[model samples]
Target: MHSRKPFYLLVALLFISGLAASIYRGIEHNVPFLPGKQVQSWAVDAKVRFQATGEPAEVSFSLPEDPAYEVLVENATSPGYGLSITSDEEGRRAIWSIRQARGQQDLYYKVTLIPTGVKQILATEEPATPEPYSWPATEQAAAEQAIEEVWSRSATNLSFAQQLNKALTASERSQNIELLLSSNRPAQLFVRMLNSKGIPAQAVSGLFLEDQRRRQQLVTFVEVYHDGQWHLFNPVDGSQGRPDNLLIWDRSGKSTLDVIGGINSQVNFSMLQDTRSALATSIDVMMNNDALDFSLYQLPLEEQSLFKGILLIPIGVLMVVFLRVIIGIKTSGTFMPVLIALAFIQTTLLTGLIGFLLIVAFGLTIRSYLSKLNLLLISRISAVIIVVIGIIGLFTLLSYKFGLSEGLTITFFPMIILAWTIERMSILWEEEGAKEVFVQGGGSLFVATLAYLAMSASWVQHWVFNFLGIHLVILAMVLLMGQYTGYKLLELRRFKPLAGE
Candidate 1:
């Protein structure tokens, strides 16, 4: 006479938590609710070519830095050189050094990146301090005059940058603008002027992504620190905000490539865009987001594949519960069908069914003979276990001899479960008569087949493996069903005569 309120409340809480967690994972991690969803990715290849001096050579190249995108993979092709990745205040760089080199040396670095749909504002704990500027008197005068003019025409830091960029690229520019452009790059001068006015700014390089493009080089952009976050602006046209296809390559205001012992060194990029399954991208996102600590994906690939099959057990168990509790279907051993369904996953439906029937039938014949010995219960079960193993081996050998390769999978069946099943059936036959044995045996087979169908489904496998919350939901459903006290569907047939009355 326990209160059912607590039971119902527990079920509701479990269901809600499971459903909410699954929805959050789908939206937050970009995991597709369904399989086969596609996500865009880009692969960029950088080729560095230079003439060697027959001496020890060293080359350094900058790596991409974009908070809006996640790097999926990266590697370098340096046959004779030692490659290593190093990071510093400047940023991450790939350095390749060789003991001795002569003539033309070619090096290649490649990377694949996927958009994360994250905002690209750069935030720092403390406001950046501007670097000291010491140019020649004429250049200093020019920079100061240009800054004054832009300051007079602008209010905010962003507006001042826009005005200065416009003046630098004007159709008819002023004398100071011409002087600044003669000796300095546009983006570099723009940043310097912004910094001289006590606004922190830096010149960064970005690549405008285009499909199937080759021999591409990085373009410079100015990043001005305003309102506590760095905002990107195209110094060429003063267009503000980061572009959807722009990948920030270098933000350290340093050289992208530096060769210590080579001449005429250059790096050119080739890029291609493609699409992949959203599931694959989700793994990358999880790895980048440090979600692997709680994810099955963190397991080695072999273990992950093993769990994929193991995680389907609950689906089979759920099917068994529904069939037995709601429909009053009698099964030999409450969950033996679930294990049999697991075997079916390995051996496939037809082969597993045939193998199961052959082994059980052969074992039952031997089990009947053992019943005459009047052995102890434990000893009787042990004898059946050994007999079940023998039956499995004999059937497997026969299948192989007959060239039925599918029978090899019979080894995957749980031998102890089969032995216990045979023992139970033999006891049931002796006590309940042969007709009752067939009824329960057929029901077991029916339930196992249905469980196999449910567990082997593609969508079911995807959801169970990708989202652990599904197991919780299944647990809730099973618990709720356990409390049922209503009439079974099969039992209702006994009242058919009353309908006519």
Candidate 2:
């Protein structure tokens, strides 16, 4: 039992494992299983428009990164502007320079993003405590009182930062906080006071992403180090964390855009929402993996497009196997239906069937006449091919003349296969009568039509192209069909007479 069953059992197990792994990976990467769950992506534009004087100009702008989203591409307009992009320990920037400029000018930076919903660990540098700020005598007394008030009530560095932040924002702030914040920015004062308590903190800005945002601006917040990690806090409400929609733009709390010869420089962001296929998004995951160097997505664009069509052949093969083996359908050749189904892909099903029948009928008639000539096999086959080609050419030209464009696709039918089919049917008719010829010929067309429907389905095409492992499952199905020794649906008709007995 073990020896006989092990082979098929192993095949089934491997097929199941491969199918499960493919589906698991697909779901893990957010590939949609059904039609309704469209993949979501975002396109963001950072427009920097400014005015230039009749002098040399230098403009610098800070860039943003969303730790939870994948950045696909970055495009910037640098017409007439000397553009230089560099990132250092401080942060990244885009600097645009020119020799001479005047009047209104515009520059744009755009980025495409796909939300992976995966959090990225920020590469943080050594945390440094901010240097204490100088204060005038009057301000010094108020600052000392404010720090002492919250520090006395706090238990740890984190609580001290939280408490100090609360006091600065409280409706009734102590005299020191009132003086300090009135003279300095709220986030700026928060960082200074946090370091006064020996805690490292940085003022940062985050962008809130939304659909159709016209002129978005950055919101500044403070990041405090606690337990070996940096945590976000709201500057206005002094909340404990950032929002889900927030994208950290600047951690240095420095200027985002800079211009020497340009003035009134400002940055406005626009956002657009896009719904993409889940399979397309899965390709994005593969594109990021270094191990997938040989994936279809890594191929040249032309090859990738070609494989998109080639991959669906397996689906056609599966359909043919089901129709032939499991359903007991008769066909002209073993795999001829599969090839016909492939041709049906380019030429639509209705037109393909009509063209197939018309060509075969006429070719058979001509084949009958040639059969009486006693020609050799090779000569007769060649003659049939020439006749098939001539018939196709005539149909194409007439269709074009009459504006019946659908007939143009008749060229997609395989000339050699049609010729061979016609020759086979003519010989079968001469020996086995017209009835058997029609039965097998109709069955082939029927199976090919079903294969065409299955192969041309959008989801089948997408899945076959996106997940290559699905072929193992298809192979397993064919193997199972091969083992079917029972009566087919068509053969069940014989049992109808037994039921009466």
Task: Please tell me which predicted candidate would have the highest lDDT against the true structure.
Answer: 1
- Residue range 1-501, candidate 2, lDDT tens digits: 347487689678869976996798577655665544566778888888889998999988887655676666677997898998888877778888899989888889887777767453344566766677766776778777888888899998888888877887788877667778788899888887787767888888778889999899878888888877677778688687757777777775687777898788888888888877666666665666553565677788999888988888878888887887778888888778888998899889999998899899889989999999999999999999999999989888988999989999989998999999998999999999999999999999998999999988877876787677888888888777777888887888889989888
**lDDT accuracy of residue 91 in candidate 1:** 83
TM-score for each model: 0.84, 0.83
Residue 401 in model 2: shift from native, Å? Answer: 3.8
lDDT of 1 at 155: 93
Give per-candidate clash totals: 0, 2
Q: In model 2, how large is the Cα lDDT of residue 495?
A: 92
Badly placed stretches (over 4 Å) of model 1 are 1-13, 16-38, 53-57, 79-82, 98-103, 129-155, 163-183, 274-291, 294-305, 362-383, 433-435, 494-501
TM-score, cand. 1 vs. native:
0.84
lDDT of each: 0.90, 0.81
Residue pairs of candidate 2 with colliding backbone atoms: 60-258, 142-176
Q: Alpha-carbon error at 251 in model 2, in Å?
A: 2.2
lDDT for each residue of candidate 1 in 64-179, tens digit (9 for 90 to 100) = 87888788889999998999999887789999999999999999999999888876666755566776677688798877877888899999987887788788888899989888
